[model samples]
Target: MFSKSKCFVGGQIWSQTTRRITKWLKEVKSSTIRETQLQPTCSSPVYCYGPLLHTVQTAEPKLFKDSKTFVDMRMIHSQSETLDTFNKLMEKTEGKPSHEELKQFVNKNFESGNELENATLSDWKENPKFLEKIKDPVLRQFASDLNQIWPGLARQIRPHVIENPTQYSIEPVPNKFVVPGGRFMEPYYWDSYWIISGLLICEMPDTARGVIENFLWFVEKYGFVPNGGRVYYAERSQPPLLASMVDLYIKYTNDTKWLKDNIDTLEKELKYWLNVHTVDVNGNTLLRYYAPSAGPRPESYREDLETAKGNQALYTELKSGAESGWDFSSRWFADTDGSLNSIQVTNIVPVDLNAFYCGAVEHISNFYSILGNDKKSAEWKNIRDEFRESIYKVLWSEEDGIWFDVNITTGEKRKQFYPSNVSPLWTKCIGQNQNMVEVGDRVAKYVSQSDMFYYPGGIPTSSNRAGEQWDFPNAWPPLQGIMVEGLANSESQMAQQLSFNLTERWVRSNLRGFRDTNEMFEKYDCEVPGRYGGGGEYVVQSGFGWTNGVILEMLNAHGDELTADED
Candidate 1:
């Protein structure tokens, strides 16, 4: 009876091995892992009993573990010899394979198996080896989904694809630039700034620099950094931050000459946004910037106005108010502008854009001073001050306790409470007394209240249960970081509390998910704790760069200031 049982188990192992090897060989091309002429001896039961029984006995877990230890020890002894062989091959190949060759090699070597197909939950629990192999595959699929929905998330969150020097040569894809969320993100200029902050936290200064240089290169090659570099990316220009990035790069590398060379390109980008994109309305001459009529679609509330044609009309109308330097025509569209013609209407002034322009001017002035252009420095300072004064005079709402976007055509405030109203405080462009206190109070109120802007993760980009929820329950890392830094600058007690709250929430969220399943998700659903917010409508990403970067920076700043002393 014992002999019969051993033969039964042996037959099972042999059949499994034969099926696995056949399937693997069939899938691979003839060029790789050629099949040997040797065949299994199924005809002779005696031969099967001899080797197969011995194989099953030796493959027992206890014996296999000991065998593996011996094999590993042997490998350690031959490590030097193996390394030498590898080095010789590398030497013979003259360093690295070409891009095409590397791609072919990867294609040949990488194989996806059917281990995950129709895999049941119980299967994962029972099969440790199968579960282990599918872990990375599952993550990769999630990442693919993230990249498709939120392209920016991919760029900001995905792990850096590293090329081994010996195996592959890295090359840029033609007519391509790194998109924020994913592989083919619709390029946006300001978005990269936040993305860079995350990169900095990863101690990836080189990658951070490459991302910055890509923007600078775009500015040099195209005269202006279009909302993004691609044709589809021409919707709106974001706040100019090339000078700030240059400053940041200098901070990391102390490469003054690099700053010097890029200074000209930076200056041009500044001028393009400040002079060309902005307009002077009613003799105020305050700095005004334009947002492409195309706003973020997935984030916006109204589905009807999210179309390209609708946004185009909005853009055309906005251009007409180019003279006012303050356009608010687009603000009311989602609220009350019922006509499709209303989509073309522009003249709406955006508070965040103006505030960002203030920051750009301040950075440019600082850059000029660094370059010893004192005269230009003074000029920029004067311009900055004038812009600041106009912002206070025209945009401030004493009753609302916040700044607002004004209608350039109508010359009235939009009366909508949004986060952009408080964003200017981060720029330090507002006054110290009443305006600061009021803005601080508003920010504190929004952050502390759970049903409003506050969420489990962090302060939402816009407020929930408000007129518009742009700042509601969704927390973006860049915005959250800026707000934390801004509040700290103002010395608001709320800043510390909010920072701690956000940091703890993020850390806990990551730990819970990773500890439970050994996986990291993209974004926590701010409205619903413990659930993943469906990624932006592009791709599901992993290692979300900005999220990881911001979390690190925020945690680092938990008991300290968010910005350097220079601010």
Candidate 2:
């Protein structure tokens, strides 16, 4: 079920208001479960849940520092044989096997390293025409290096995985796809959007098309895409960017026939979110990120267990936070201390999630329009209009000069300085009545006046220095892409300049970090230009997918103006 490649290893609380919160959460979970039950789910024997998984992930001293390592191991024999051996060992030791004994059993039965092998890209081009736009040799070389990273991060499931499905956690895809390197071996949900964009820029549309097709395969098999290409992530999903990826692919390829073929699947995926993840806010329906699952994440079993401290509700919240793609951020914490235990991701109606929905529906509407389905096109357009209206009524804050995530539980706005607060601008979900120019100008000024500009390297994910990777001092590539795209697309000149400035800083930091370390990091220390980011569950990753994508996107957008001369 795995390929032979390289090996890299990688919430909670209560209250009296807790009673009402708990009750609401239960109702929400019940409703979501019922909705999900109507659809076919691609369940795995060992990845999502099972005795073998539980024993290994929770084993004392841990089989691997990163719990994902154990789940990712391919079995040497059939899964039933492996499980029988494990159960026999447990019975022999009366369910109290020594850590070493368990370790030995695992080593004997499973592959010793990561499940995904490095896949070479047949479409990789050494010099893309996009790079010729860069006048500066230093910047062009850096951009070239980023382009070269594509093949190394490409991965495909082993053929044995298809023959022996139960022997692995990885969901098999028919084609090779790029991964966000350094322990993130499988293809992720939203990361593919940027990866595909970068691939197209590198003149690798075939590779980009393959990744999109993999996601389409997921929607067909699972009725929705999982958070990543693993069974453990089946119950959860990251940002709803499948349609966005489709949009990007069409722009680069102009493949209307492909859109016609896959439009139904896209609608099915969108309906999954609309049916399962939507919530009510004062009678208006909006979307929120929710992962209706139990137990600590198999990938992060130990860390989630210790943080939750046996609280199942807390575990669920942690998983939901992870589903938001900003796991362990202060933006999700309910307390002022920024404690992991205080995370309340379910209560909050995230601005970015809703904005993404808005964008997705609009794209779907356009897809239908292109396919000459005027009736369905009009229907999706109406849905988009209604959703945009709800977002404007519920999430926008004229007083604060930006949109905010509203707490569905309390009906109060979370008026924090999060990069996501500007997502509506990015998604262009600023309501049908609002003037784009006026709104863009105001939002641009708001951003210009915020603490984001204080970071010389790039925009921090949030103003809070919560010691989480998604918090202060850490600037992630995806967040940078969001802010830059949001502002650059605006009618406000100041906003466009701010976008360019942020773009320049991010590209410089990535370039400097690559120059110093000879690597492209997953996240960077926004406070230190050349340093890689550190915080959260594991060591900072390298050969990152989105990082390379964002930098290449920036280079493509502003290559003529950007210079590599010492600032």
Top-scoring candidate (lDDT): 2
552, model 2: CA deviation in Å?
0.7
Over the stretch 322-366, how does candidate 2's per-residue lDDT look in tens digits? Answer: 899998799988863569998888888999999998999999999
Which candidate comes out best when scored by TM-score? 2
lDDT on C-alpha atoms for all candidate structures: 0.45, 0.82
Poorest 10 consecutive residues of model 2 by lDDT? 9-18
Error of 2 at 549 (Å): 0.6
Candidate 1 lDDT over 172-261, as tens digits, reads: 112223344333233356656655654443344565666777777677655666554432223335566666666666766776677777
| Candidate 2 local lDDT, residue 364 | 96
* Model 1: number of backbone collisions: 45
Report the error of model 1 at residue 136, Å: 27
Off by over 4 Å in 2: 1-45, 113-115
lDDT of 2: 0.82
